[model samples]
Target: MSVEIKISLNKGLYLKEPQDSKLGRKMIKHSIMLIEKFGFEAFTFKKLAKEINSTEASIYRYFENKHLLLLFLVNWYWEWVSYLITMNTMNVIDPKLKLKIIIHSFVAAHKENPNVEYVNESKLHNIVISEGMKAYHTKDVDSENSKGFFKSYKNLTTSVSKVISEVNPDFKYPYALATNLFEMSNNSIYFAQHLPKLTDISLKENKVVEVEDMLLYFTNKLLKK
Candidate 1:
């Protein structure tokens, strides 16, 4: 069964909400495909407009620039993962178990969800792994942060951090650990696939059990103390 998910993101990220119109949605759908195919630096409004059968001016109507468009996609991804965590951990009372489920959700969220026909979660996950940091690692990040542009990512971290606190109230670095686990899930997979020397896990075909096991191992070891 496929359910429609509507994720509300920061208004500052776009001049117009891309989800509200067919052309806007087409712009987003192709933006992801273009970015994933050519990488972010090579992606441009001109190319996107050509690919989507729209004009550069039309693309500009939806987004101020390509950077903001990237941020919008990245923020959407963070919210999706957060939603998955909620769904996966629902009614699970054990904090340790909930944390375990979070690890699974982090890994599993990379898989495609049929519900969101426009956004390919798998390709978006790859984009997040490779190009996500560019969204905030900029001189303008502080100004953007002031406008709540990064709230979706922060909210995802906070939610996981709360579960970490529940598992061990005395754990002093819940937020750090929470964010690290999520980053590690993405990083380790990227490393295994492209830079195998950096990670101990070996990449296999369409499976990430090693990444899940490694995250669970670390979480258990850290929280057991």
Candidate 2:
């Protein structure tokens, strides 16, 4: 059975929360689908408004600009990932296994959640892989950081860092490893798909398992004291 999940993102990522109204929700739903369909660079409020039969000003009321909307979607993706890690690890006793599960969750092909039809998680995962970094790689990043724009990502790294510490209390670079694991999880697949020479893996059948195994191996070796 597929479980339904509600994702709440950091407030600073949006001018007004989209979940508060029907049109607001529709905006998010269509935005996710459109962003996945068209790359983020080509996505715009005018296009979104036309798709939803609403005015661009209506979207502006919820978001200051397209950047904020993209940030909100990416932030929501990270929070959803964190939620999955927490839910999957609950009641597990082994730290190593818990970390393994976390690594696997990061690279695994996303499945659509039937209950949450508005957000196609599978497409969202692909969007994150392709355009997630654009949300933070800008001149305004410093100002955004000061406003807690990257809290979900930070929390995600911290969550895995804790697991690393659990396995080895003396491990000195938990945060670094945690962040690296997160980056590499998406990066390996990105490289494999777009720049095959950069990665040994491929998008061939069971390649996800290979990537997962590579991550687990790296993580286990690093966490092993």
Candidate 3:
């Protein structure tokens, strides 16, 4: 994974120098700002264009639509996390420790890019939940769009399962376990703030077991026979 001269997938195309980078960062920054100012339900192309000091046509060059823009914003964080993960384990070979360090590295990745950690994650959640609710409640459901989103989510879950298997080979229902693990971790924050009753008491604790801890513990409990 000794990758060099990395270019973020979500960054805008073309430009002379670091302005491209700044402009790209501003897009993500403004996206967060807009989402906060007007919840996902109220988000509009015109608002984003105005906030970024660009026209809808210009923004369209980078993102085809609002959904895609949110997807890019969400994916950017994972891509950055992957980059950080590769950077941390130069000589580490032990699988279990690798996963643990991966957890540590995840937190460090957040530290490295706080924008995605704090801002975009919230926006990402809002977008995801809103769309999901829309599809759920709507009668004519855009089958294509729902299927596409579900497919991407499935792949993401499978990827997490594979990572779990890499650390401990015998975890039963790897993907299912991974799904519960990850879905709980992500939703805990979003849900706890609202439906605290649906959450377990452990999630209420000040010192809680994080997603990585749950994954690592599941690995040890199920695989270390």
- The candidate maximizing TM-score is 1
**lDDT, ranked from best to worst:** 1, 2, 3
Query: Candidate 3 — what's its lDDT?
Result: 0.54
Q: After superposition, how far is residue 39 of candidate 3 from its true place, in Å?
A: 2.7
Instruction: Name the regions of candidate 2 deviating beyond 4 angstroms.
Output: 1-4, 112-114
Clashing pairs in 2: none
lDDT tens digits by residue: candidate 1, 35-88: 999999999999999998889999999999999999999999999999988887
Pairwise TM-score winner, candidates 1 and 3: 1
Q: Estimate each model's TM-score.
A: 0.97, 0.93, 0.64
Global CA lDDT computed for model 2: 0.86
Stretches of model 1 off by over 4 angstroms after superposition: 112-114
lDDT of each residue in 1-225, candidate 3, tens digit only? 332333244232222222245555566677766765576568777887788787877666566566656555555545555556566665777766666666554423434533332244444444443332332244533553444533444554565567678866766787877556544555554455557787543444433345446556655776575
Count clashing residue pairs in model 3: 0
Model 3 clashing residue pairs (backbone)? none
lDDT of 1: 0.91
